[model samples]
Target chain A: AQSVTQPDARVTVSEGASLQLRCKYSYSGTPYLFWYVQYPRQGLQLLLKYYSGDPVVQGVNGFEAEFSKSNSSFHLRKASVHWSDSAVYFCVLSALTNSAGNKLTFGIGTRVLVRP
Target chain B: GPKVLQIPSHQIIDMGQMVTLNCDPVSNHLYFYWYKQILGQQMEFLVNFYNGKVMEKSKLFKDQFSVERPDGSYFTLKIQPTALEDSAVYFCASSLYGGTYAEQFFGPGTRLTVL
Candidate 1:
């Protein structure tokens, strides 16, 4: 019953605006959390991943994510978003379970639209 | 950045026909995997392969599906008598190893269309 939930189906932000996408995961044990972005017709690109250590991890393209075990959440954030950042973002979860081999359980995804 | 490559990018096949999706994983990686994503749905795990063996597979991996990588070549996912429900974008990923310690890199994916 491991699953990821992205409550926001779509998020819109103006260029140069700060953005935050919410993600919640349900797992009994500590989880490896990741954020991935997919452009149209392209494969997913990993933004960041959190296995342990610092609660906040920085990723490529000025993206960052914070993992909270208490809340079972790993939310993605950006200080400022560009039009190029508009894409579908997925929150993925992995653990040492039968369901998680190289396989990841992904959220439904949140489509970000950067408006000018 | 590591790169995984998938072949064809797109494919169209009739129902009940067999289709094989090819994936070229990153060199020196020991773990390979396949995932399926329908439009507007979350990408789901299909199976994982390591050391030329099927390590684990989800329910989505029907019996009609099989995976192999001969002599460390392309990792192939073959589905026999594909059904319309089988039509989806298939993503191939590879990691240096399996389990929880490795990071998986993904390919561009192959869009399989079953008509």
Candidate 2:
């Protein structure tokens, strides 16, 4: 069975400050990791995904994530955040198997608040 | 960018009432999926459909739940005998099937409140 864990439930950062949201996953095979963002009353939007190769992947809105296989972690980071960055971020892991139907196991999610 | 549209952005219903949520996926996408998220909870996968059949479903998908993509049109999730625990935001997503890489496009979501 595969699962994802997000350490922080909520995080607050001042505008223009750096941000990092932690995410860890438990999976046997090559894990396809992804980051998604959801604003209030809005659908989730994919930020970035990492399957293989480059451990660091860049995403929209100046977002990026680093995949560390040894640590079993993929943390999202942004050099500077804006008030618009206030939203819920989710880390998801998917196994590369035919039986799984590419179903994603998502972390509980971390709510980010950017205050001015 | 492609989009998935969900109808009835929010619905309030009494317990035990039957409710059907609708989703209009991207015009050419062949894969559709459903996910549920309660207040302050993770978004969990409920089911995935392709080629007019359910390819996968999670434990949360009970017998009372059904999914259909009849006439190759809109996809729908029908829950019979809704309970208080069923109150959550239901999201519909679509993706290109049999592709080299799959990226799902999610709908804004439908908030269902069962009182």
Candidate 3:
């Protein structure tokens, strides 16, 4: 079984400041990782995804995440955040199951508040 | 980017009643999925459907729950004799394929309130 953990339940950052959200996963095999953001009252939008290749993957809106196999972590970061960036971010893990399709396990989500 | 649409952003039903949540996946997507999230909790996968059959379901998918996509129409999740515990936001998602790396696009989610 695969699981995801987001240690930070909430994060507060001033607008134009750097932001980072921590994520950890528990999976023995190769893991597919994803970062998604949910704006107020909106559906989740993919920030980025990482399966292989470069450890650092850039996402939309200047967001990027680095995968660390040694640390079992995939943390999201943004150099400068806008007020609109305030949203709930989720770290998800996907792995092949015994069934036909893959199932996604989500972290508890970290709610970010970008204060101006 | 493709978009998935979920019908009735919010639904209120009485306990023991039946509720059906509808989802219109991406036009060319081949896989559909349903996930549930209670208030202040992580989203949990409920089931996935492909080729008009349920490909997989999690333990959270209760016996009272059922899913279908008839003639490529709306993918529906029907829960019979709904309990208070079934009250939660149900999100519908679709992907072009079914694999470890397939990206699933999600709908805004249908909030079901069982009283």
On TM-score, the leading prediction is: 3
Worst 10 residues of 2 chain A by lDDT: A94-103
Give the CAPRI class of candidate 2: medium
In candidate 2, chain A reaches a TM of: 0.96
Judge candidate 2 at residue A85 and give its lDDT.
Answer: 99
What's the best-to-worst order under DockQ?
3, 1, 2
DockQ of each: 0.58, 0.52, 0.78
Q: What are the lDDT figures for the candidates, one per model?
A: 0.91, 0.90, 0.94
- Per-residue CA lDDT of model 3 for A5-82, tens digit only, reads 999999999999999999999999999999999987778899999999999999999999999999999999999999
Chain A TM-scores, one per candidate? 0.95, 0.96, 0.97
Write one digit per residue (lDDT tens) for candidate 2, span B1-115.
7878999999999999999999999999888889999998888989988887898898999988999999987899999989999999999988886432478889999999999
Candidate 2 interface RMSD after superposing interface residues = 2.7
Question: Which ranges of candidate 1 are over 4 A from the true structure?
Answer: A98-101
Query: Cα miss at A5, model 1 (Å)?
Result: 0.2
| Docking level of model 1 | medium
- When 2 and 3 are scored with DockQ, the better candidate is 3
RMSD of each: 1.5, 1.6, 0.9
Model 1 Cα lDDT, one tens digit per residue, A1-116? 78999999999999999999999999987798999899887778889999999999999999999999999999999999999999999999987856335568999999999999
